[model samples]
Target: MKQPTLPFWQVWNVSFGFLGVQLGFALQNANVSRVLSDLGADLHSLSLFWLAAPVMGLLVQPIVGAASDRTWNRLGRRKPFILGGAIAAALGMFLMPNASIFVAFLAPMIFGGMMLALMDGAFNVTMQPFRALVSDMVPNEQRTLGYSIQALLINIGAVIGSILPFVFTNVIGLDNTAPKGEVAQTVTWAFYVGGTALLGTVLWTCFRTKEYSPDDYNRYKNIAPKIVEKLSLTTKLANFWKLFINMPKTMRQLALVQFFSWFSLFIMWVYTGPAITQYIWGVEAKWFDAEFLHSVDVIPADIAAAKGAAGDWVGITFAAYSLFAAIFSVFIARIANRFGRKITYSLSLLAGGIGYISFMLFQNAEVVHVNLLLTEIDIPQGALNLLLPMVGVGIAWAAILAMPYAILSGSLPADKTGVYMGIFNFTIAAPQIVSGLVAGQILKYAFDNQAIYIIALAGVSMILGAIAVYFVQDNSDSTPDERAIQGH
Candidate 1:
């Protein structure tokens, strides 16, 4: 039995919640390093602090995946988990930037780190079910389109989330710089807005999407309906171990690809703020040191202002890449169908590799003025050139969000889709965990504490990921006639 092709609107609704989820993530990625730095985290410890995100994913995703597989309630199988996770994530978003409020209990950086972990844990709980839902609902032929639509919504949310801080600071004239121990109002407001948006969008998806009943799911996926039995803890653990040991061949092959891809992404997220501020704005790393902050009543006015401006600009650069990814997602399904997923994914990662490598090439700090409609804004000359590289990163990001899942979904057993999808996240989480563990040391010893070289290193890793993609076997490849009919 084949799953019925959902209407385009239903397909669109299936992934609409991802928009809010990605919004929360984009804010985290674009600003967390800057937030931690402002809260007194040092340059050498940024990656360690960043470990909170992937670490949470490693711990949360599989458990949520397996639990959701057996969950069937009035709220629907995936929707309950999705709604619950979103509420928790929204709370985390509201609290993370305001960690300074809890300084009496713990240091601001420590509090912020704890909030980051909570937010990411909730994100993982929400994300894995969404991945499995697409596979469960969409027929084999529409898988690429389903995932591409998801990628599109994700990037759109990212674009908006990435730019909110900049919009608050630059357009609304919010106070971008605050005291040494406090976060800027611009960032604080962005989080408030993002948290609200996250709840609203996720609620839309939960209310609109109707999951298949157990019998219907079994019939559609061609699986025999077995008695629902509550397994003991030992049996559950044993089953999880068995699944891990015998993961699909495609999943195993894609692990290396995922490793390189996420390692590069982790580096970019952890270092981009410091890289842009120090490399372009010439802000010293020592300025953010905890001891230094403790000794001085207030940071020097110039350094504080420059750091604030640079942080805002970092948001713009991240938003640029997300915007590019959003644009690329529209045609990604057609591209994958035309050239094959392997070729499409490989070339995209190669482009992102080149983009990351090019970051070091533009170092000019001269200011440039650009008029937008009725207003003019000043931007760094070097920073303006940075958007060029983001184009490549954007293409790779869109493919990264869509292609692997499209390939892996075909190879999964019908009833086990949720567990396998959760298991696949290990590939994404492990590389990031490794990168977080060693990246700061690499920067300190090999790169002489220069964050820009770390960006270049990310480029190399992406190229390696591009090479590894060729080794994966794409079980979901379409025939020539199918491609022709799909307008590829």
Candidate 2:
């Protein structure tokens, strides 16, 4: 059976929804900490608050992927999930702003966060089919470009999400002075924009890029007979347990490396924002409730007074990291072409490790120069420390996105790409669950809010994840190049 190839522009149109989808995702990643803290939630307990993210993801992702794979309706296999997710994301955005108070130990913030988590899975569901759809719809020649276009859209969406709150506060005059660690009106509006875009962009793809009918699909596509027709939860958990039990020689070795790599990234994402705000902004988690009251009069001018020279550098530091990622995205495919997937991955992780190590050495206040330097800029030790590592982190991030999939997609059987990818993504999503549950406790109990040590752990994880890459062994049995590489 032969797969049909869509024209380049059509392929781009089908994958277009990811632009809006990532907008919501980038907003979730960049702002969740800021939002949680503003709503009077305890920063020390934030990792636990974030635990909702993985719980929902682990529970929802496989099921949604399985369900969508089986779905056949007028709206098509992928559309319902997107439409539903968009609706939920909009509601979560609106509800997030109201999360300032507790109704009997159930913080409105927690409730809203759970809603966002639910929305995350629904969005993720539509995502799988689109990837598989590319294989189903595209020939080999255009795939590299097809995926790159999707990546570009994703990055563009992320830039907007990352900067929206900044735009909202600086230009739109939405007060950044929400309660300590609470959601701001401007951030809330960004969500509204993100959600609306998420729904509409997907709707455009659903209508414009049509799926082949079952008979035509069967005529051209080499699909295996459906496995199980459906899988029970017990069965899925059984497979996850098999991650340890009866593990293959290849996979077991990989797991040890994955654990450390993920642990580092978990710490970096969960703690960076609040940690930056606290040590530099001098707004401790312990002072959150007091800062909430100051919302009536505590302006940016006031916060700037507290932080001294560090405040201005904070945004630039974040922008610097994103800029690195934007550039990294362009060269990634070339690196994959040159080094072979596993080797390229290992090298990227090593670079990130160096970046993380640089962070520890550079934390001295004397190390940072002013961006413009006309006024003799001396930023806070904390912000300067974080910015340096972000360069490496961006490189590490690019590898994480491209490598494992390249390995897995090569190996997975064509008949069951959806299920296998779902199972594989478990590593990525499940680690988030663990990180969220443990990061805050580690900060509060292990190090007593000495956030620098936690970030160092992330660097260690990169070194470890790099080590694991060697063990991964590139078991891409079904990859397009598999037969040629084996010289069979």
Candidate 3:
């Protein structure tokens, strides 16, 4: 019943779809707010508009997970769901940046919200299966390596997706500005390229890898199969609730860690655009007309330029973090080996917390020096300041994507991997729901509309998360090298 160690290339092939999946996610994270703002959503109302993503993830992921667990087909179980979700997500991404065109007759908010929901739902549908597949195929000892590979591919895709808008406008001569009530050409083209990457990479994984059949799974679990019948809708709902109420001890502990981790990220994703624009670029909502939400024209040329520049900087910050994530992912297993997963993950989160706190020093200053490879490059202080925090965020992100699953997958019942994994999504989606509901209100009232304060709050939340992670009981097994030395 032992699962054989897959060759390194095979392991990479199994998780490769994440690269494409993350391209869609990176595009959404880096650009969605800017698109909403371009369509004239007020800062106070922005979080409400962003609610569609978590709401959809909450509704979709568990259902897809439960269904996939019971599914079987010629094309294989997880592959079908992955392919379907990728297609739907790619379509949503393609339509997202073009939402302003619908404003001729329909409200831009309504169309844009629909596309966001569609993209989120599709992404969740694919994501759960990808996580479960790694659990399904990889043994406990290799879980960190398998998941970290996915994390590496994720950041690589993120770097490309995050930098696309910046590259389009600054390097390729795309107009970053549109007349009032329209998305910029740079963002529009970025979405186009992201959509293509989403579909293409997912297709690559689908064609190159094959999933274990249900019969093979039954053999692995030492169970005999009778004639299988599909569950009724009522039973699926009952099982979903039952699984929630009876989560394992490890899942319960990891839930606390995931709560703060995702909450801090939700805040960053929502406020980073406004924070940079208002704090760094000195652009305010008052400088432009909100009436442009309904009709075009009368936005000052200078204000539009400032907003465009701020959006590009946000893209650069995202790319910097993704770059760091890619660099750190390769070393995560080695670091985890020396420190153990708990201390390693906790330290990463602590570093990210300090990084977020560093935002407070980002005054509208002049030149900043960055030392890299024995050379010092001088750049604008705002740009240099933002890049420094990403180092910690990237390290924490690598752990976030790998460690919890590496722990929880070992404890889960093999027969119910899909359902339990689906339940894990609650830890991620619920926090975003909480943050989406309250983050904007906190920014407006608590800090007097100072968005930079939200990043500081995120830093505190991450530090608290590091503390929570320190107490979780790790059940991961030792690697083959260690086992052989022990004569196992």
In terms of TM-score, the best-performing candidate is: 1
Clashing residue pairs in candidate 2 are 37-180, 37-181, 37-182, 38-180, 38-181, 38-182, 39-181, 39-182, 264-458
Q: After superposition, how far is residue 275 of candidate 1 from its true place, in Å?
A: 0.1
Best by lDDT: 1
lDDT of 2: 0.62
| Window of ten residues with lowest summed lDDT in model 2 | 304-313
Clashes of each: 0, 9, 0
Which is the better candidate, 2 or 3, if ranked by lDDT? Answer: 3
Which residues of candidate 1, in runs, are more than 4 Å off?
Answer: 372-375, 477-488
Candidate 1 accuracy as TM-score: 0.97
lDDT for position 436 in model 1: 98
Q: CA lDDT of each candidate?
A: 0.90, 0.62, 0.81
